[model samples]
Target chain A: MKQISTRLSMAVHTLCLIAMLPHECTGDFIAGSVNTNPVVIRRIMGMLKKAGLVDVRPGVGGAYLLRSPEEITLLDIYRAVNAAEEEQLFGIHVNSNIKCPVGRNIEGVLQAEFQAAQSAMEQQLSGVALKQLLSQFKE
Target chain B: MKQISTRLSMAVHTLCLIAMLPHECTGDFIAGSVNTNPVVIRRIMGMLKKAGLVDVRPGVGGAYLLRSPEEITLLDIYRAVNAAEEEQLFGIHVNSNIKCPVGRNIEGVLQAEFQAAQSAMEQQLSGVALKQLLSQFKE
Candidate 1:
């Protein structure tokens, strides 16, 4: 079955938690909130750090969002996680028979459509900011 | 890694081939072009048949498109194949720690965003007719 990366949602969740309470954002704490292994949280945190969306200090450090929730969109989280390859939003069957007319040309045709679809999804994601999501949480 | 269903593309390819050469679309032949097992082609063909997008005969028969290529869209093919669940497109981590405020509410927030993104993708898919795709193939 086709699946979007779980990492994207987890990253957003992690960031939202950090935005909500930045001081207590250790990997262990985030993992507890995310309900995943600290190793998993660290992996995602590593990606977010690389993307400049989050900062992680050395041995004694915790994680924190680099930007305000209001300034961060789901698109930002998505890109930070690097969850899904844009080109792979609709995969082309790799072993298509090139000798077959339809097989030879389907990739080009489908790719254009896939690109459009992916762009639409990204645009939709961009419209939703982390602040909007954070606001949904009850105190 | 996250991936979109290849079945959606394969279904389009299968239909394109059937439309291009209506007479010789046996499961084996389609599988050759798809470069997958005949059973795989049959599986997709079964879904297409259920969707009323294609017809299959009992014995000594093959697959054929039930509608003209112009009448079919990638959205139709996507739905036919049930490519990805709209909710599953952005999976919420099932194990979120309910004790955390953000974790407790994250699913509802992400779900709404995922729904919007899915709608956008579906709308984009609906706009591209299969005939438009088939037109890209060289004779």
Candidate 2:
């Protein structure tokens, strides 16, 4: 049971800290909050940075949201951390015996269903903004 | 950028073959259609067998759906193959620092959203039956 990477949740957790405590979001500080190593937080922050969801201030070492919390949906964070994995959320075995009619066409038949199912999950993700998740947190 | 295991799709493909060509579903046959090794087919079939979705004959090595195609939903196959991974489809990072409010509460806040997103995906899967996928395949 290989699980989907934990990067997605870690990215979300990273972003929450950035939103909740912008001044305190140095890599180490954030890593402490995430209960992981600084290197892991740095890696996830790098992805977030590339996605234009967050920006890291150089020299001083702090991060902040590039977009408003409401503008950044869970889908955004999900894509940021897992852009590569999302391209094929559901993988069809490539060498499916082409001789068998069922094998030959199974991939093509399952294609739309996989996409629909992935889209349904992402649709729920897109519905939840980082602001929404942030508001759910208690002081 | 890790992806969910291929076992889910492979299991579905195996089920499709079993339901479509009941008599020819020897492990080798299904493996051929799946374009994978017999061992791979054996592993997936074991999961399906354990779930009681399919029965494997002892002597000659053939498999048949324990339930009709209509009775078997994609969700069942999904569960059969990836039961271990689904317990927490969206895992919250386990070590969030309890000292920080956001870190301490992020897992709890995100729990419902993760469950909802997973449910949306599973809902789509459960809605689709093996019969529906089989009907889409060509002769």
Candidate 3:
């Protein structure tokens, strides 16, 4: 089946938790909320940190949002995790017969459409901020 | 990596070839153009046939487009192959901690956003007809 990676969702979830309670945000604690290993949480947090969306201190330090939730869009989280790797999005059969007209040209033919569709999806994602996502979590 | 299924592109390529030359379109011929095993072409053709987008002859026959290329949208091909299974588009982590507020609500919160993003992508796809895609292939 075709699938978008779960990294984008996981990153958003982790960020929402940190935004909700920045002081209580540790890899172990966030992992508890995400129901995954702290290692998994740290991996995603590491990506988020590299993207400047979150900050993680060394040793006993915890994680916190670098930007306000309202300022961070879902697109930010998606890009933070590099989840929009469009080449993989609509896979061209690598072994397509380069000798054949259809095979030779199919990739070029579909590239524009796939890109437009991906852009539309990302634009939709960009419209929703992390703050908006956090607001949906009922107390 | 995040990805959309390639089945949609394959189906479109197969259909474009069939539309361009309906009579000579056999699984072997399509496979030659697609550069995959005839079995793979047949598999996608099977789904397209099931979706009523194409017809495959039983004994000494080949494939043909059921509808004019002008009338078919990328969305039709997508649905034909079940490429848009939303669950696969943005996965919800099965192991999310049920006791946590963020865990309990993350799926619900992201569900709407994911749906909207998916809708936007499909809407973009719906705007482009297969005829337009076919036009992109030179010679």
- What's the CA error at residue A2 for candidate 3, in Å? 3.4
Models ranked on TM-score: 2, 3, 1
- List runs of model 2 lying over 4 Å from the truth: none
DockQ of each: 0.70, 0.74, 0.67
What is the alpha-carbon lDDT of model 3 when measured against the actual structure? 0.82
Ranked candidates (DockQ, high to low): 2, 1, 3
Better of 1 and 2 by lDDT: 2
The Cα error of candidate 1 at residue B52, in Å, is 1.7
* lDDT tens digits, residue span B1-139, model 3: 6456677788888998888888888989998888778888898999999889989897876777888888899988888887344444676676688888889888878878888998999999899898997777766
Question: Which of the two candidates, 1 or 3, achieves a greater DockQ against the reference?
Answer: 1
Which lDDT tens digits does candidate 1 get at residues A1-139?
A: 5567788899988888788777788889999988989999899999888888889886886777788888888888888787445535777787688998888878887888899999999999999998888878966
**TM-scores of all predicted structures:** 0.91, 0.95, 0.92
* Number of the top TM-score candidate: 2
- In model 2, the clashing pairs are none
The docking category that best describes candidate 3 is: medium
Clashing pairs in 3: A89-B4, A97-B35
